[model samples]
Target: MKTLLKNGLMLDEQSKKLVKRDILIDGEIIAKIASEIEDEEAMQIEVAEKLITPGFIDLHVHLREPGFEQKETIETGTYAAARGGFTTVACMPNTRPPIDSVPIVEEILEKAEEAGYARVLPIGAITVRQLGQELTDMEALKKAGVVAVSDDGVGVQSSKMMKEAMRKAYALGLPVVAHCEDNSLAKGGCVHDGEFAKRYGLQGIPSEAESIHVARDILLAEDIGVHYHVCHISSEQSVRLVREAKARGQKVTAEVTPHHLLLCDEDIPEPNPMFKMNPPLRSKKDREALIQGLKDGTIDVIATDHAPHTLLEKQQGMERAPFGIVGLETAFPLLYTNLVRTGELTLAELIEKMTRKPAELFGLPYGVLAEGKVADMTVIDLESERPIDPSAFKSKGRNTPFAGTYVYGWPVMTFYKGVKTWDQADIFVTFEE
Candidate 1:
C-alpha cells in the first residue's frame, strides 16, 4: 500500500522553510519526500495546512501490564501513545512481575508485538525485582532486546549495588537510567518540602533527597565510564549538579517531565492526589531553573514520565495515594501549546528533543523522516483547540490533573511503521498488505 501526504508544512530540522511538500510512504518506509509528487494511484491525504514531523518518541512511560492491568495494559497504553502522536515508548520495569530477567523482557516484547499499536521497548530492571539489592543478568537481558535498565519507581539505595549495576551496564554498552531519590530522606513525604507542605501540614520530600542521589550517580558514572541518564528531574539543585557534571565532561543526560515544566507547588490548590507524584512538584524557582536548563541544553529531553493509576487509588488523600499521572496523551499538546506556541521553544528545537535527541541517545532507528527510514510519523492540527477530556483517553487510568484545561495543537493522525494506528475522526482504519 502506498500513501501520499500532500501539500503539508514539513518540519524537518534540515529544511530552512516549513516546506510545502509531499511525503510518499511505501510499506513501512518513507519512499519519497519532495516538492511535488503526482501519484494518482496512491491514497491521497491532504494535510496542506497541518504540520508533518517525525513520530514522537518518549524515553519514559509506565504501561502497567504483566502486573497492574487495571491501571493500563500494553495495548491500551500504546493506543494512548498513538493518540498523542508518539510512535515509540520505552516502558519502565516496575510491574507486578517486574521485567528483571530475560524471560520477562521477552514476554513484554512478545506482547507488544502482538498488540500491534506503538512500538514498546521494555526497560529491564537494574536490580532483581527492582529490590535494589542484587543486579539482574544484564547480558541475558540485553540479548533478549531490553533497550535499557532502570529501577524506576525508587532509587537504588546502596551505592555499592548501583556501582555494580553500572559496571555491568557499561560492559554491555547499555545505559543505566537512574531514578534519583534518597529513600531515607523521602520517607513519609508526599509532596515537596516547601511552603505548600508547611501550609497544609503534610510531610514533605526535600530536594536533596533527589539531588543527593544524582550527585552520587554522576560521580559513579565518571568513575566507571558508563552512560547514565536521569529520569524526571524536578529540583533546582539537581539541575545545577547535572550542569556541572556535563561541564566536567561526564557521560550524563537528563529528562524533565511536562508537569515539572508547567506546574509548581503553588499551582496545586489543595492536597489533590492527582498532583501527587514522585519527586513531587517543586518551587517556582526550581521550575524556572528546569525551563532554563531545557533551553540551554542542560536537560537533554522532555519525557512524559507517563505513570497511570486507578481512580479509586487517586481518590484517596494525597499522602495515601500512589504517585503518577497520565502523560502520553497530554505531552505533545501541552508542550506545543505551552512551550512552542508561547515562544519558550522553537518548533524545530521541540521536535529535536522529542525525536532526534532520544533516538541518538538510545541508539534507536526511528524518530526521523527520510528515504529508507521507518514510516513512523504524526500529523498534527496546530490550530485545533480542545479541552483535555480524560474520558477520551485510551488508557484505563484517568488520574490527570489537567482534566478540563483547554489546549491548542492536538494530534489528529498517528502512524506506526506506515500503518495508521489512530485517527480521531476515523478510529477503525486498518492498513492492508
Candidate 2:
C-alpha cells in the first residue's frame, strides 16, 4: 500500500523547508519526498498547514509491565506514547519483576511485539533485582533484545558495583543509563531539600545526593571507557558536572524532563501529591541551569520519565505518596507552549532532542524523515490549543500535576512503521456527531 502526505511543512534540523510536498510511503519505508508528485493511485492526505516531522523517540519511560499492570501495561503505555507523538520508547526496567535476567527481558520484548504499538525497547537491570549488590547477566540480556542497562528508580549505592556494571556494559558495547542518587543522603526524604521543604516542616532530599552520584558515574565511565547517561537530571551541580565531563572528553550524556525544566519547588503549592516526584523539583536557579544546559548543548536529550501510578497511591499525603507523575501526554504540549513558543528553544532544536538526537545516542534507526527511512512519523498541529485533561488519557494511570493547564501544539496523527495506529480524535472522541 502506498500513502501520500501533502501540504505540510517539513521541519528538520539539517534543512528546514516550507514547501508543499508529498511523502510517498511504500510498505514501511519512505519511498520518496518531492514536490508536485503526480501519483494517481496513491491515497492523498492533506495536512493543511501542519508540521510533519520524524516520530518522537523517548529514551526514558516506565511501562510497568510484567508486574505493575495496575499502574500501566505495555499496551496502554504505548497507546499513550502514540498519542503523544512517540513512535518508539526505551522503557526503564524497574518493573515489578525487574528486567534483570534474560527470561524477563525476553518476556518484555515478546509482549511489546505482541502489543504492536510503539516500538518498546526494554532496558536490562544493572544489578540483580536492582538491589545494587551484584551485576546481572549482561551478555544474555543483551542477546535477548535489551538495548541498555540501568537501575532506575534507585541508583546503585556501591561504587564497586556501578564500576563493575559499567565495565561489563562497556565491554558489551551498551550504554549504562544511571539513575543518579546517593541513597545514603536521600534517606526518607520526599522533596527537594530546600527552603520549600524547610518551610513545610518536611525532610528534604539535598541536591548533592543527585550530583554526587552523577559525578561518580562520570568518573567511573571515564575510567572504564563506557558510555554513561544520566537520567532525569534535576540539579545545577549535576548539570555543571555533566558540562565539565563533556569538556574533559568523557563518554557522558544527560537528559532533563519537562517538569524539571519548567517547574520548581517554589511553584509547588501546599504539599500536593501530584507535584511530588523523585529527584523532586528543585529551586529556580536549578531550573535556570537546566534550561541553560539544554541551550548550550550540555544536555543531549529531552525525555519524559513518563512514570504512572494509581490514584490511590498518589492520593496519599505528599510524604507517604509514591514518587513520579505521568508525562507522555503532556510533554510535547508543555514544551511547545512554554519553551519553543517563547523563543527559549527553536522548533528544530526541540524536534532534534525528541527525535534524531535520541536515536543517534541509543543507536536506533527510526528518527529521521529521509527517503528509505522507516515511516515512523507524526503530523502535529502546531497551532492547536487544548486544555490538559488526565481523565481523557489513554493510559490507566493519570497522576499528572498539569491537569487543566492550557497548551498548544498537539499531535493530530501518528504513524508507526507505515501503519496508522493512532488518530487522536477518531479514537478518543466520545460524541459521534
TM-score of each: 0.97, 0.98
Tens-digit per-residue lDDT, 1-433, candidate 1 = 9999989888655664577879999999999999898787789988878888889999999998888998999999999999999999999999988998877788888888988889999899999999988889989999999999999998999999999999999999999999999989999999999999999999999999999999999999999999999999999999999999899998899999999999999999988999999989999999999999999999999899999899999998998999999999889889889999999998888888998899998999988888889999999888978888887788888999899998987888898999988786843232111
Residue 199, candidate 1: how far off, in angstroms? 0.9
lDDT against the true structure, per candidate, is 0.91, 0.90
Best by lDDT: 1
**Model 2 Cα lDDT, one tens digit per residue, 1-433:** 9888887778644466455667988889999988766677788888878888899999999999989999999999998998899999999999978999888888888887887778999999999889988899999999999999999999999999999999999999999998998988998999999888999998999999999999888888899989999999999999999999999998899999999999999999889999999889999999999999999999999999999999999999989999999988788889999999999998888888999999999999878998999999998888878888888888888999899999998888888998877786753473233
Q: Per-residue lDDT for 10 in model 2?
A: 84
Badly placed stretches (over 4 Å) of model 2 are 12-17, 427-433
Q: What is the lDDT of residue 52 in candidate 2?
A: 86
